[model samples]
Every structure is written in C-alpha cells, then in structure tokens.
Target: MVGLMSGILLAPSAATAQVSDGGTVRQLDQLSQCRAMTDDKERLACFDRASAAILASRAAGDLMVLDRKAVIARKQSRFGLAVPTSEMFGGGRADEVTDVRQLDSTIKTASAAKAYGRWNLELANGSVWQTVDALTFGPSKGDAITLKEAPLGGYRATIAGGRSILVKRIR
Candidate 1:
C-alpha cells in the first residue's frame, strides 16, 4: 500500500495539479510534497509525516469518513423526517436520486394522538409518524405500511393495502 501511494505521490505534475485545483485534501497535499524529495529515505519520511498529520486530524475529530452503505443506512433510518434531499445526498443538486424516497416497515405499535381519532404510529424500524389526514382508518399493530413521498414534498402513508393518507414524522 505504501509503495503504491509513494508511486502515485511521486508523479509531481499530477500531484501539483490536484493540489492547485483544490481537489485534493490537505493530507494529500502534504503527501504530494513528498514527491519533491530526491532521496528514498527523505520521501518515506515525508510520507510518514503526512500520514501522522492525517491521523492527528482524525483523532481531533476534524475528519470523518463513511462508506456508501453506512450513509444509505442512515438515510433510510431518517426517512419520513423533514430532512432535505440535498442535505441527505451530500448537498448535491435537487435532481439527484439515490433511491431513498420511501420506507416499508411493519407497525411496532399504534396509539391515538391528542387529536380526536388521529393516530401516532411507531414502526418496527423505530420511526414515529402521525396521521395528518382525517382519521377514517387507523393502522393496527403489526400492519405493513409503506410511507411514500407525496406530491408537494409531503408524505403519504398506506397501511396494508388500504387507502393512502397524508402523514408526517413526529419523531
């Protein structure tokens, strides 16, 4: 791993271009400087120094790295909430889609809200949602539910093949 990194770092023009373009992180900029060293020992020392800096930054909580799966799991767990799509997808443009528009889970529990006939639903995944539409039907415990994105950036929930109703996440 170190040998491959050193080879890539030794490409001075490319490394310089990446740094100047502001595409490379600060740690990479440090490692790229190692390419300027002519002696192998000096270059290795520079790489070590760069690695130590990266570790220090991470230890200080200035840097965090997450894989796609972990991020997607977080997005799924946060579904039904009012989080903007741009924020959820790493601040990308509004048109980007990573397939996190809906959530399917069985009802873990259900109870009446303060409003007459309004229901508060707790899904198996631990998200809490409340019915916003008129209470014509109430979801029962263990009922399969699909919470989908409705028109105008709202949520519509359907329980066990019943009619869809407007809903919002309360927690």
Candidate 2:
C-alpha cells in the first residue's frame, strides 16, 4: 500500500501529460511547459512569464486566437478571392471538414462591362464577380444568385434560375 501510494504520487497528471504533445503555437507551448514543472513556485513563475509573453505577442500582432466559427466565417467571406489555399482556411481532411463550394446571395447591382457584353455583378455579401462568358440574359438588382466552384477552374454564377455563366472574382 505504501509503494502504491508512492507510485501514484510520482505519476504524471493530465496537465503534465498534455505538455509532451507538440504544439504549433509558441505562446501556447510556453504555457504548456509550465504544466511540466514539478516545483510549485517554479510552475507559478513559468505561468506568469508565459502569460506576459502571450500579451506581448498579441499586442505585436504575432499571435491571434480565433474560435472555429470565426475561422469558418472568414473562409466563407474569402470564397472566390484569389487567396492561396491552406489548412488555415478550411483546407484539411475531407472527411472532417469540407471547403466552401458555393455562396448564395442576392445581387446588389449588375452592369455591362465595356468589353464583350460581359457583366460585372455585385452580390449582397460585398463580393464582386465578373462574368467570363458573354451573357444572354443579365442579372438585375435584388435577384438571387448562387456562385459555385467550377469543376474545371474558376467559378460559375447562376443568376435567378437562369443558366450558369463562367465568372471570376474581381474584388
């Protein structure tokens, strides 16, 4: 019973166990290191130092903390932009998380460009999409539109139950 008690006392706690798992964030890693310290005073000191470092990083714009919802919202907002793809913006395991495939919105405005009868359409979500293909029927203000990822390349915009036209985000 005495040996059992000794073994239990020496065993790593849950907090300390997590410290061994590698973390990608430096400020978070610093805080995790505090859990591994055995000495009470040393652990407390480490925590204080880590907290200060986190504050400094945040103020310097070197570190940011975002909830999953905020990250997903950001990804949706940037859907048709020319931004590079990454795990940071919904690029991950397909089974776990799928990328944004389409955006449904109302047309804020639509105008014909000077060249080739192509149309420039502004959506309610503040995304400006320009048609790559010449339009037979142009979209109008307040018309519901759906912008989807084209299987080949670029994007396709379906305007108010009309046919899909190849489009690209201009803004």
Candidate 3:
C-alpha cells in the first residue's frame, strides 16, 4: 500500500491512459487528489504541474488527442482509399464518413503506363493505386504521384508532368 501511494505521489501531474475515444484520456484520480487540497495556491500549483506533465506526454507520443478540425482535415486528405477510421472522429459519428484516405505513391513498373486505359501504379510505399478513369498520358517509371480528395468524394492523382487522373487506391 505504501509503495503504491508513493508511486502515485511521484507520478507526473497530468497523466493520461489510452481509451477507445479519439480525444485525450485524462486521469481522474490525480485530478481528484489535486482537488482534495484545501489551500488554493497548492491546488492551482498541482493543476499547473499536471497540465505540464500531460503536455509532455503528448509530445512524447504517449498519447493522441485529435480535435474536430483535425478529423475533418484527415477525412479530406483521405478521399478515395478505403481505410478504416473509426476513432479519428470519435464515437464513429453517423454523419462522418470514415472510409477514405489519400495515398502518395510512385510508378514502379513502366509497362503499366503503356496502356492508354486503366494503368496500375505500384507505389514506393508498397500500396497500389489504379486509374479508374481513362488514361491518356503514360507515366514513366519513378514518376512522383499525389492522390488527394476530389469533389463529390472522389480521388484524383496528379503525376510529375502535371497530368492528372482519377485514381482509386486498390491496396
């Protein structure tokens, strides 16, 4: 009992644990302890220390806290790929769509570019993106590609030569 109490006392001011929610998990026990303090100055100091500790933990990658703005931005960034994202928006809101993500890749095989129709692209990142729309220009090997959200919840990828194509992430 003494060891546990001592450990708690020595622990950082603001502590958080991983939860299913997308927001930061706050430790209530430490917060309650600070509230128990009768002195106003001591309570304030305790809260300040806790806040600092929480910030440190976040910086250390020990915790993840995302706001609504971040969620919306990520959703926009990932428009065509079917990546599951339930916790990014928290509670998997009914109105929020969690089945899209953007992908950055490079042309691995130059043979796929020869076809004027659907061209398969093997990205340097190992994910594959294919052009869903008709392909006019052929992309050379090692072409830099950027896949981003397009209007109407579609994804468009632009190649190094400023040639754009409607692509879908297959992998």
Candidate 4:
C-alpha cells in the first residue's frame, strides 16, 4: 500500500477515479519504500507506523470504497435507458423535474367506445387511462397519445390532431 501510494503521490498522472475531496489517487507506490531502508530495525518501525496510519485513517472516517456493483446499480436505478451522461452524470444529482409536460404512451389496448360515453385506454407502458367525462372521440390501438396535467388537477388525454378528454391514470 505504501509503494502504491508513493507512486501515486510521486507521479502526477491523472487517475480515472476521484475521491470525495475532488482529489485523485495520490499516495505511496508500494511498501517497497520502507523495505528499501537499509536498517532492519528502522524497516520494522516503518511498517508498524504505516499499519497504524491505515487503521487510524479507517477509524477517522476518511475512506470510502464503493464497489463496481454498487455504482452500476446506482446508475441503473437513476437513469432509465442508455444512461445519457450529459443529463445524468457529473457531480449533480438529477432529481429535478425541468418541465411540466404531457406523458406520452402508445395505446396498446383500448376498450370499445361506449358511444357518447366514457371509454378506456391501456398504454404500452401499463398505464390505464379512463375518460372521466364524455368521450365523443376515442383512441385506437397503436395511436400515440399524450396525457398532460390539467390546470387544477388530474390529466387531459389527447391524440395527434384528435379530440381530448379529461382522463385519469388509474395504474
């Protein structure tokens, strides 16, 4: 550990990982440095000191090592697909909603229109949107539909160049 840490400290080459302090790995290259000392007594003392330092650092809450699996799972749970770095990466936590807009989904299965009555539409993403008011016009399978937040509350469903109705997402 000393030798590895020494080389990192000695060599200024950039490392891929950054610590919480915004500093890259900088430390002794390996324990060989202490071994290289000529006196056996001094070498033993040096090794003891390094061991104690490692333990002290651990006790001081100065180290955190995240395994690859933890990072992979964090990234997966955060980003939906492809994991675009521009929007989801870097030092920022992307938990903010940047816009209020329509939630679009493909109509997978739709209940038969009740002729001047409310109807039902099941989206591909498993959201069931049913009309709350009269639905004179209805959607068909494979139609791209959008549900936008209504002014007061609830949602309004509409298809491209089609009629819109007050719809609510049940599931």
Candidate 5:
C-alpha cells in the first residue's frame, strides 16, 4: 500500500516533468527559426508570430500546446524585445501589468494627442513616463494615423480623437 501510494503521488509530478521538457523543446525550435532568419525585422516578426500562436494555443486549454507556446513566447520576448524574462511576455507576473500599461499608453497617447510621425511612448506604473516627439501636427491633417508594414508584419498606429486607441497585441 505504501509503495502504491508513493507511485500515485509521483505520477502527477512525472507528467509535469514531461510537459516541461516538451515546452523547452518547442521554445528551442522557435528560437532556432528566429536565428536563422536573415533580416532583423523578419527575425522579430517570426518571434512575434510564434509567440502569439503559443498564447492562442494556451488560451484553448491544450496543455501540450500551452507548454509549447509558453516556451516559444518566452524565447521570442527575450530575443525580439530584449525582455530579460518570460514574464515580460504575458507570464501573469507582477511586471506583466506594467508591460500592458506601457503598450496601452503607447496606443493611447498616439491616438489622443493627434501626434503624427514616429513616436515612442513609454509607460510605467499606469502612467506615461516620457514622450519622445509627443506632438507632431504634421502635413497630414486626417485623424487617422497610418501604419506601414513593419518587417515583423503590419505595423500601424492611428489615433481617433477623444477615444481610446485599439492596440492589437502582436504576440
């Protein structure tokens, strides 16, 4: 009875170990693809797609897919965005909130201020930390901000006045 109980107790742990191993493999594969990519933008894009795919898979509740996606997301976040940790890629940690806020601010400021041209909006602690080129009432007079296709994929930012910016998560 003692031996049987021990085996049962350990079973779950063993399964978990296997899952972790599988996830690691998937991440490595994605990283390999990113490295093999020739263009800088292409590499970043590959990482983003792989990361997003992983997130979507996890949302579907497939453990195997979740594990693989998690790993790939971590790798892509690290290599593409210089994010030091996987938590930066939506790992549900404390810092994840900060990332989300930053992304939100980037979208929000671009939309609200009617800023045109390239603007890098940084956010921290639910507030805009700094705005580089915060205002550019450039030649374009339309409320819409056009985004060109970035190397990673379609990269566009547009601001509708007096409204929240809709930011589509890349990955």
Candidate 6:
C-alpha cells in the first residue's frame, strides 16, 4: 500500500517534468529559427511557423499555448498583417462614413478624418491619428487614407466616439 501511494504521487510529477523538457526544446528550436532568419519579413514568418508548431505540441490542459499564440500574433502585427478587433477601438462605438478629401488628386494626398470626439481620425496602420477641431469635413465610408506615398493598399477603419479609431491596413 505504501509503495502504490508513492507511485501515484510520483507519476504526475514525472509527467510534468517530461512536458517541461519538451516545451524547453520547442522554445529553443523556435529561437534558433528566429536567429537564422535574415530579414524582417522572413523573421516574422518564422515566428508564425514556430508559434503554430509550439501551440500544436502543447498538452490539452496547458496554458502556455496561449502565450505562444500571443507572441506569434504580435509578430504578424509587426508585418502589418494583423486584423484589428473591436476591443482595439478603446471601448467606443464604431461607425462607417463616406467622402474624404484628398490634399492632392494623385490619391497620394487622400486623407480620412475619423470623427472620434472633436473629429479624430486614424491611419490604416492603427498607428497614426489626425485630429480636427471644427468637425468641419470628416471621413466618410469608402474613403481611403494615405498612409505612405504611393498606394500600398486600403485600410478598414473603426471610428469610435470621435475620440479613438482603430485602422487595420488591408494588405
């Protein structure tokens, strides 16, 4: 009876130790791949691949999978491929509007002024903002904002209460 009780107590600990070793190996492999990558694009891709692999290898009840997923998600965002969620809008209601004016007709000067409190606008990368004081000419639906010179792509805008906007660049 004493031997059986000791075995039961030790079994879980051994399994846990095995899992820890596996996780460490996986993480080391991922780090090696990241170090081997040459460019920003390739590095991000590597992170994505490694993260997926690690997540798949995680045990059913392990919470570490969530951390791995988050790391990959952040890497994807650095590549400008992330899709913004509603929660990114800073806890405000989002609306779609139309008819933005271009500073120039070449489409390079186009600007979308998102009216989040007092006319606040956001750029496609969700990294920039434009604020207007008068609310006198704001962004409308189907309007595109120029994030950089020349057309990279279009962005979807989530305007919130004229205070904050979340823009996800559509690549």
- Quote the positional error of residue 136 for candidate 2 in Å: 2.4
Worst 10 residues of 5 by lDDT: 1-10
Tens-digit per-residue lDDT, 93-144, candidate 2:
5213535778899999999987777989988888888999998777789999
The TM-score values for the models, in the order shown, are 0.64, 0.62, 0.48, 0.43, 0.22, 0.22
Over 1-171, each residue of candidate 6 has an lDDT whose tens digit, in order, gives 112211011123323543344333444356466868789998998887866654544443332222324433343344333443323212222101111212111111225444444333433434333433334455554345432212444332323223323333333
Q: What is the lDDT of residue 98 in candidate 1?
A: 43
Local distance difference test values of all predictions, in order: 0.72, 0.70, 0.59, 0.54, 0.36, 0.37
- Cα lDDT tens digits, model 3, 2-96, are 12321111123333343325432454335557879999999999877766765676576654454445555565454445664544343434224
lDDT of 4 by residue, 108-141 (tens): 9878555467777777767676778875556678
- Candidate 2 to truth, TM: 0.62
lDDT leader: 1
* Residue 116 displacement in candidate 5 (angstroms): 86
Q: If the candidates were sorted by their lDDT against the true structure, best first, what order would they fall in?
A: 1, 2, 3, 4, 6, 5
Q: How close to the true structure is residue 123 of candidate 4, measured as C-alpha lDDT?
A: 79
The segments of candidate 4 whose C-alpha lies over 4 angstroms from its true place after superposition are 1-93, 97-100, 112-116
Write the residue-wise lDDT of candidate 5 on 1-171 in tens digits: 112211011123333432344344353356467879999999999988866655544454432322334444344333323234435333443234323211211233322333344333322212222122334442122333322223453233344333222223222
* Candidate 4 local Cα displacement, residue 84, angstroms: 24
lDDT of 1 by residue, 69-96 (tens): 5556677788876666436533443224
